[model samples]
Target chain A: MTNLPLSVPVAPNRLSLSKFARRSPSAAIGAALVVLILLVALFAPWIAPYDPIAQDIANRLMPPSAAHWFGTDSFGRDLLSRLIYGTRPTLMLLAIVILLTTPVGIAIGIVAGFYGGMVERILMRITDIAMAFPKLVLALAFVAVLGAGLVNGALALALTAWPAYARQTRSETVSLRKSDYLAAAEMMGITGPRLLFGHVLPLVLPGAIVRMALDLGGIILIAAGLGFLGLGVRPPTPEWGAMVADGTQVIFDQWWVAATPGAAILLTSFAFNLLSDGLRDLMDPRNG
Target chain B: MSLVDISDLNVTFRDQDVGRHILRGITVAIEEGETFGLLGPSGCGKSTLLRVIAGLNRDWHGSMSLLGEAVAPRRRFTGKLRRQVQMVFQDPYASLHPRHRIGRALREPLVVNGLDNPDKRVTEALAEVGFGPDVASRYPHQLSGGQRQRIAIARALLLRPKLLLLDEPTSALDMSVQAEILNLLVTLKARFGMSFVLVSHDPDVIGHMCDRAARMAEGRIAATFDRPALAAGAAAAR
Candidate 1:
């Protein structure tokens, strides 16, 4: 018998941060912007020039001055400080929603895809019903029932967010179920959860993560919308959507009031979008 | 007793309203420690029959027995039957999981079966396929087609299965690599004393590897060749 070659060249196991940045500049920029926002949120108290909620009637409506950088709102609160504090709730809500939805959605999807037939029909139909309703309307209905607090708002958004993940994961799992590796695993007597979670779940994760990143921007927009409608965090607590609502009243005279928080929301969503696009490109099977 | 026995095996796939008959009444018996070849052209259901024997395709009409135990249609092979039969697929590139390392893939079957000393078993299996210990750390994408096929062979043999079903195992590799893999299979089969049901379109491969071979056309065994006939290249003629 001919001997197989001993020395075969191997691809690098890890992609360094610098290499990743060089490969996809937009993702790098997005990551940097996200890190900056996280830092701002983390050190809001230390970084803010004045207390976010503390009103200084004398400084009310101040515009782009040396003392009040982003100017003061109608409540005479610092717009910059309020924006800084606002980042906290938005990020917190996102984390909560992701934690709640990813596992539930993936589980429902894998079970449906793996079992197929009647289980697939029932689970997918339920996912479809959940998906059929307008996301904002369903979230609004949920908030109306649950009452508006940070966790409740997060819960409402999470309920609407999971169906899309379920659909994405289910479709991926359906195709993966036919793959040769999975079939080989089955032949070895690896069945049930061990096969599904061990063999199937890892293959489906990259796509699901890319989907999650893409969904982040949309989740932020919906969260901000809830805050604008007075169904978010209780009053006097800084929220980007509430701040924009606060800005709209004096938009004609003082555009900075609404503009500052509006700019923050736009930048945050844009960062997530760029990050997701880069991730999708990197994780593409063709690229691998 | 025969290692594998099947009589009148038929497989039909139903899509919506139409039922397509893929395997139409195939009967074959493989003696213990024998290499039986199923030689046929594309779309002749050789791979389907291999899948049936491996228990990967359970939806079939047949009276089948493996190592003397009968198997029912549309039922999963359980316990010893499940572990005794293993299959290596056609494409080397697609057979192994892309994300998993070679070591993990080899250890998986042993781990699943609750066998002890998985690491040692993985090392031994790799060595049996002419691979060194360092090869274990590499991913499937890193390996060449020949290397991947060897790894696939090692994984199937890790369970010490009684019957190994090969679905065009070397068809994906080039000329030189195919010979190496086929030789490797010959040596491994001799060492393990295992029966193999090899499916291929090439008559040369069948004559080289199989002790008793069947030439299939349109899902039926058109001719069966003994050692003398195969040596005379009777399979290639008709």
Candidate 2:
């Protein structure tokens, strides 16, 4: 006769701030940068020193000074003001691509993988066709047909970006569907949506999150590239890429004009990349 | 009147390259509240037979009935069958969903079957399996092998099923853990008075827990050891 109740109490699932900070320092740094950038993007109007499009002809192409920190572009529009406002469209492009692509891709992938055979063949073939072309070239072509603008460019990027997510989610769903726990859940009467959402989705979602994080840097770069190519926002909108392209006319004489916006793009892209790197390490078990 | 009856059951996997026969013309009957053991070597179809009875594998030709209801092997299990028959998988690590906490895992069957008081039931089930209240909040990875096994058993018992189909339940644990799990199973069996069709390659496990045991070879029942013969054989082997 042995004592039977073998249960032991444990501390609840709460991570102390210091412990979290210590464990994922890189992720913390990445998160801080992302948050700071988001804040700047959100508070552009309130924080910007001058009207972005307001021209001061006398101060044209002035080097970095107290009155005009990033100096003034060829048109004499305040360069710092333009760059601050430019964060809006850049962040908006990220939001649109993520909002449109993530859910659509995840849905198609999960559905195809869960109900393999005919459904998988149909969905994967469509994805393959989308993925066959160089993503930037495909988006460029799409924007050309749709007529160039920020909306068309964003849509093109979204079209190219969704397939990656679908492919990722499909592979994840395929593996998760084969796990014994899924079989057990199915046997216990957990079927259809409940099985897919409850048992399968939870396991696959972390991988998707990590993938989304990794894709952020690339998507941001592509959006800026589209802007630089004149396929994004029309002139006088103060878009960073457009501003940089405008400054290229007097490149040798007014180096600061192009260099300011170019540096902004580099810094923003780096912030996203660092954040993605930290997310990959934190979210992906293989990396961790 | 037997609690479970299966006659001339056959199972095969139809692969594009090769069709492999798994279970061939197997027949067995188990009474209510009886502990039935299936002893065999690997690829002997003992586990397959247990799965069929649990209604997990439906792609088979079989006439089977459990607790007076005809057992149908379909992708989805009927709620009545779900409430009456539950299964415990061999690999404790793989049996429970890795992402789910112990509490959620235990509550799932109850919620699926529309049983009331999941909060109370989860606590009771954990206590019945000799688990502490705090164990529910922890993931499977947080617990030891034996503790996970106990959680799996606790999960099965949450539904208060009449028959538990266990496939090599203790084979994955250490010798000490194995003994403790086996003892726990024995204690729980007596307490609940539910039927068990325990499948294992270990003969000593069969001799210890089962009142009547069958030996399977190549998808067929090769021999059976009744209660008295099993006791005598244990003595003789010792």
Candidate 3:
């Protein structure tokens, strides 16, 4: 190698959490809410003052008071305890759906994008058909055929949700396929799997992650919707949506039972949505 | 013996219908260690020809031989061919992977070519391109236009290719940076003793760096000229 000046000692900026929080306080807040929810879910047995499913027929449908902070449900189950325990199944379903869908969708998208023409046409058309169906309706139909359970509900939701990731990632891959860096890589005799995993995947992944983050809240809501419809996790389980569904019966007489779970769902879902927005802003290079 | 010998090269968008010809029966030759310039306007197939030599466009009717060996269009380039030829793209901004550090970008070619000790090679190559160890850690976006181009060149040279195919390497840069890059390329060429097929629209660039030059128009080589020994004489006199 020819000699040239080693003039500069570069110290590039490191991305620290505090820096990120300062840049996007909304994301920070969202993350804090999510962490709080996770902590409550993890420590539900310890944190919850009462057993979620222990029926006290005498205390049934009581209004909010210090003795019963969120009052009692129609079944006389503690509303606060049930709300805390409910976070577990909601988050569990979300985790399962994400695990099942993200890889499947990303794989399909990469294949469709890398090999255009007949493969792309066929894959995209299938995705289009899947995407056209209302996600909840499609999940309901799947549950109708498969029978109702947490696993079935998760499977159904994953099946319906995968198309969004597939379509989004496919479009991302399609655009990046024509990238000059890829063309440069091709010229350097870097083709096939190495080119795909090393080059294309890295470029396509951040966008997919942003989309996944945005979709997380929707996934949680859908899981809850499935539970509320009596198609998720079965009865006797202390799930938020099921709790809300149970409380809906005595609406005017006692609002605390339904309101507690409903508020929990609203707050958590809102936190997720805000987190996604914050994440989008944080990850976006243009924002920086 | 010619380093690049392409003959009767005919590239069309569609072979079935005699579709629009991109390169029409074009031929060119360059000697080993010679700086050959392709002077042409935009969309005149100059870049296409360079791409063909770089083994990017395979759908073409041509007999292409580098260092006197025929190349098959659809086949993977042989290891020797890969190591013997490298290209510096026109747009420096778009050429380097946006997500990768300059060091990784330089190392990839060596790794792909199965070269041993890539870390040492990359460090040495970085220095050759007027970059320090710190530059290696920096992403392409962090660097200036000229620095990015230098990284691209460093990436090309990591494999120590016998021939460098440069497509408008300096045209995108400011006029000041253009001269610096031109000088860098000329110096590197002397040190490496590698041939270059430089494509540019600027005649001054052609006159400054090239030993022999050719003008291209509408997918054909319109004319060829020999400069007075790498323009050193003319540049000095000016």
**Considering every candidate listed, which one attains the maximal TM-score?**
1
Worst 10 residues of 3 chain A by lDDT: A3-12
CAPRI tier of model 2: acceptable
TM-score for predicted model 1 compared with the true structure = 0.98
Clashing residue pairs, backbone N/CA/C < 3 A, model 3:
none
Q: What is candidate 2's fraction of native contacts?
A: 0.41
lDDT of 3 by residue, A1-288 (tens): 354453444444687889878988988889899999999989999999898889999889989889889999887888888888899999999889989998888878988998799999999899888778888898899899989888888887888788888888788899888777998887677888888888888877777788888888888888889889999887788888888888889888898788889899898988888788887776664443
RMSD of each: 1.3, 2.7, 3.0
- Against the reference, the lDDT scores of all candidates come to 0.89, 0.83, 0.84
Best by DockQ: 1
Worst 10 residues of 3 chain B by lDDT: B229-238
TM-score of 2: 0.92
Chain A TM-score of prediction number 1: 0.96
DockQ category of candidate 3: medium
Candidate 1 chain A lowest-lDDT run of ten: A1-10
DockQ of each candidate relative to the true complex: 0.72, 0.47, 0.51
| Full candidate order by lDDT, most accurate first | 1, 3, 2
Error of 1 at B22 (Å): 1.3
Please identify model 3 stretches exceeding 4 Å from their true place: A1-12, B14-18, B229-238
